[model samples]
Target: MTTTRRPGAYHCGIDAAMDVIGGKWKVLILWALDERARRFGELRRLLPGITEKVLASHLRELETAKIVRREEFEEVPPRVEYSLTPRGVALNEALAPLGAWGREHVIGGTAVTPGG
Candidate 1:
């Protein structure tokens, strides 16, 4: 697949990182990976209703961006799993507060409960 390198202003690491992971399903996928490493099928199971094509495409994009690692096992039938990189983990940590804020303000319209 040909990558179209678009010219734009990503002023910092945060911006560049956001550029990679800022999509509708990407954060959800990252949140899933935040739990544990999972195979494609497992991820699909966790996120019901996502098309295989879209998942495959996003996985490829995340892999390309170095936010996620694709590990392939050379077993009888090759098995592959996806996990977040260190950078991705850091990104997830940074997003936790935002997620909390959104859930409290956007979803519930109330103060956030600590660890709830």
Candidate 2:
């Protein structure tokens, strides 16, 4: 999976970072993989709203960015797992503050009420 670089694009560090992790699903996928390696099905189960195709696409993009590593095992049924690479770990750490903000602010407003 090779991406063609656009001429004169991504002039800043934020540009480069967003190029890798931009989108609703990519960051969520990275968060899911932060704790431990997970198989394809496990990831799908973890992220309830994601469709199979979308999850597959995001995983491919993360793998291409070298943020996530895909490991295949030789077995009777063939097994594969996805885990965060060192780069991904660093990225996740960098996102901690943002995550905290979302949890403290965003989730509070969006959570459902008992009768509403």
What do the candidate models score in CA lDDT, each in turn? 0.85, 0.88
User: Which candidate leads the pack in TM-score?
Assistant: 2
Q: What TM value does model 1 have? A: 0.81
| Per-candidate clashes, comma-separated | 0, 0
Q: Candidate 2 clash total?
A: 0
Tell me the lDDT of model 2 at 101: 87
Scanning candidate 1 in windows of ten residues, the lowest lDDT window is: 1-10
Q: What is the lDDT of residue 106 in candidate 2?
A: 65
Model 2, TM vs. native: 0.84
Deviation (Å) of 37 in candidate 2: 0.2
CA displacement after TM-score superposition, residue 72 of candidate 1 (Å): 0.3
After the best TM-score superposition of candidate 1, give how far the Cα of residue 85 lies from its true spot, in angstroms: 0.7
Task: Output the lDDT of residue 61, model 2.
Answer: 82
Give per-residue CA lDDT, model 2, range 1-116, as digits (tens).
Answer: 33444546879987788888887888989999989999999999999999998888889888988999999999979999999999999999999999998888767778555787
